[model samples]
Every structure is written in structure tokens, then in C-alpha cells.
Target: MQPAPDRLSDRRFAAIAHFVEGSVGIKLPPSKRIMVEGRLRRRVRALGLSGLDDYAAHLFDRGALGAEAEHLVDCVTTNKTDFFREPAHFDFLRGTAVPRLVGQRTDRTLKVWSSASSIGAEAYTIAMVLQDMVAAGARFHFSVLGTDVSRPVLEQARAAVYAEAMVEPVPAAMRQRYLMPSRAAGDARVRIVPELRRLVQFHSLNLMDPSYPFDRDVDVIFCRNVLIYFDAPTQAAVVERLAGHLRPGGYLILGHSESMAGNGLPGLTSILPTIYRREA
Candidate 1:
């Protein structure tokens, strides 16, 4: 009367793989099928479903597809990031990009976008760098915006609190200046200082969407480590959209392992490791 459990699981995995690949261009291999199952098992149990089959049917039938889809995408997407994860890029920004941009434009204000900013480390790192530059008499105005597709991570970013382990790599002096030591009610955790928190903003953004909402073009965009999850066509589309949001001579930073070599974005050139710049 009922389908076998393994058969149902296979069906569900197929459906999920299809949904994810279609929505975000992530190809989940058979090895990761168990990963998907493990992550969603709690959801299935919470919904009081018998197995993956029933859950998959419910997802399609009850219009719970959107939420379930988001959960799947969030689980598979890696968020391995830390403060100053790649120091050299920040160094380049400070020593080269910032000075050049400041020289080209007398106005001291600059806007930066962290396009796939997971839990805000990349964005906050940018803020710290900008603050240091300002302290060194650069006299530049800076605003950092971090965006991601996951609502849960975005909420965490807005909170600006990180576990003790996450802040360990942060320089002692920068930690003293940018973070406050405190213990959560039950857990001992250090949180970012209010001053640094005020410097960055977080929002939910879907890169695949056709439109972006920004009044002024951004001066720099850190879209690091995100393109690997996207297919070629999607990656090209995203690069084009990101390029459109940049001012002339603006910068686009990708993950160290990523390349836009064949993407055909004419005005952009690879200036540094995984960093591209727009023609002035």
C-alpha cells in the first residue's frame, strides 16, 4: 500500500537536488544526500512526518516549498569565515585601492558592499580597516553593507555577537578597540563593541534576483567565496549585475580560488588575487 522508505528517500533527495540546483546552482552529489537527510530530519520529525517521502509530498502539496527550500539551501551553503580571514586582501585595500580611489575623488566618502557576507566577518573586517585608515589621517568616510540570502545568518549578523573562538584570530589591539568583553547569561561570549556595530549594516539579498536596490553606485564589492556555489551562467549574470552597481574604477573582490577569466565582463580586469577592478 505504501512505497518503501528507501525508495521515498531517493525520491526526496532527487527532488531536493533538483530544487537546489535550479534555485542556487549548487550541485548536491550522492555523497551529500546523507547531509541533506541529516539536516532535514529534525524538520521532518518536528512536522510529525513518517519519512522523507511524506515530507517531500507535504513540501510540494502544502505550499511549504519556499521555507523548506530555504532551509535546504542554508544547510548546504558553507559559511566558513573569520575576522581578517585573508589579511592580504585587506592590506591591498588599505595600501593600494583606498589611496587610489581617494586620490581620484576628492570627496572622502566610500560605499562598500559585501555581496555574500555570511555572518558579517568580511564586512566587519572592512569596517575595521576603514577605521584604522581614518585614524591614520586618511579622512575618508566609509559605510559597509553585508547581505546574504539566509535570514537566520542575517539576524546573527545584525546582532554583531560572535563566539569567543571566532574572535581569537582578531588582533589584540583591534580587539581592544572594536570589541567589548562580556558573557552571555548562560554562555561566556564576547560581542563586538557598539562603535563597530554602528559602522556596518546587514540585509537579506538574493543575488539571483533580477533587480537590486541601491541609490548610488558602490565603490567596492567583496563577493568572495560565493561564486563557487553558482553555475557558470548564474555566475556570469551575478558578475554583470555586481559590475552594474559599481562606480567607474570601482573594485570587485571574489574568493581567492575563483576566477572571472572567461566571464566576458569587458570593463573589469583582474588586479589582484581574486580581485577585479572597473575601468575608469
Candidate 2:
């Protein structure tokens, strides 16, 4: 099959960028136009469309817009993740948050939300930390909810399989305990152990929604490495919504590079670097 020709023009770039920003709150700047074109070419070819222009038209045509917007979000959004990408967050969870939750709560049900859980690594990391806590005789019920804007990445997260390189950050003991060597694929890959997978759930979520559908209060929300893609206002708005989703006294964790310094999000007090607590 012949390759689909590049048809992303300045107008098409603007159109695609606008759709993604409006749909998912990811800001695609002018510098990302080339990256957008490159990433979207695969989608065009996969759909057997004539070119990017045709793909854009197909995306916008009538009833297909809603469904295709999901595909576009999957295409343009980046899903770069790995196990234990940030170690400090896990340390905080183990040393500070878990102890606090277990000591403070009577019911001992701990709920964590991985707000942008691309590929499930972050969610699984949270699970591992909780599992460790349980292993050390801290009696508490815990679960992780991993949500992302891209369905494809959510599917990958649900699968819970990873190549060796992706699992390299996982500690040796964790690799032996929480992951199993895969013989089915006959490759250097591993699957998250069944127990851990059971504790984590993945869902397709758009942060732009007026209200999130979480039924219960979340104890900790990890919206890391995602707000950087959005403009400051969008970041503030997302932070606000995440704050709302938290239980009073719950925590909100952001990427180290993201700053809410001047955002002045109400009801949130910065307790640590990149960590905020919702006021009771």
C-alpha cells in the first residue's frame, strides 16, 4: 500500500490543534505543528484516508466527529511513561501519606486517583506502594483508579504488560514479586502480577468535562506531567477540578515542572513541593 501523502497545512494544523485543546485541554503550540503532522500521518494511513486534509474532513463530518475525536486525541497526545518514573512521590506515599491515612481514618479504605495515568505505570506504582504497606502489616484497604484522555493508552494500561526497558525502573524485588515473566509472547516482557492488576482500574477520561464522575472521595490524586501540556489557565482549571474531586484533607500531586504558584486555586494549600492539600 502506498503511503498517505502529507496534507497537514497551516490551516489543518490550527484545526487539529484547536480540536484537541477544546476536547482534552492539551495545548498544541505552533512549535508542535510538525510533531502533530508526523504523529497524525499514521492515523491517516491506518484509516485508509487519502491524506491529512481528507482525514481532517472525515473527522469533522457530521456524526463521526464525536467518535473520531477520540482517535485524534489518541493520535496527537503523547503517552510517555514507565514504572516508578518519579521515585520521590512513591516515597512520600509510603512514608507520609499511607501512615497518615492509616493512622487518621477509622474505616481504613484508601482511594488513589492517577489523573493522567498513561500506560498504567503510575497507577501500578501506587498499588505497589500500598501492597508494600500491607506487607509490612499496615491493615488498610486500597485501590487505584487510573484515568487518561486517550483510550489506546488506557487499553495498554489495562493490559499491564511491559517490555524489559519499561520495567527497568521497577526495583529488583518488585520485579520478582509484582511482575511475572511472560512466555506467551516469547519476548523480554513482563505482566503485572494479578493481585496488583486487581487493585488498579483504568478508564477513558477527559479532564475538560464539567464535572468528573467519581462517586467516592479520592484520598490522593496524581495529575503529574500532564498540566505542562496545557496553558496556565487550563492548568489552574484542571487543578481546581482535581481539588474538588479530593476528599477534604486529601492530597493533590503535580509534576515537578508544573507550578501553581500564581494560580491561587482556592481551598488548596501547598504543603510540599508539587504537593497540595485540600482544606477541610
Candidate No. with top lDDT? 2
Model 2 spans with C-alpha error above 4 angstroms: 1-5, 61-64, 261-263
For candidate 2, lDDT tens digit of each residue in 56-169?
788765456777878788888988887787799899889998788778779799999999999999999899988988988989999899999888889989999888888889
Q: Residue 65 of candidate 2: its Cα lDDT?
A: 70
Candidate 1 residue lDDT tens string, 1-280: 9855432366677878888888766777788877677767777788788777777888877788987777767876777788887788898889888998888877878999998888888899899999989987987898999999888898888888888789887888888888877755767577778887888999888888887786346888888788887777888888888888888888888877676632458788877657888886
lDDT of each: 0.81, 0.85
Off by over 4 Å in 1: 1-8, 183-186, 261-263
Error of 1 at 188 (Å): 2.7
Candidate 2 structure, TM-score to reference: 0.93
Best by TM-score: 2
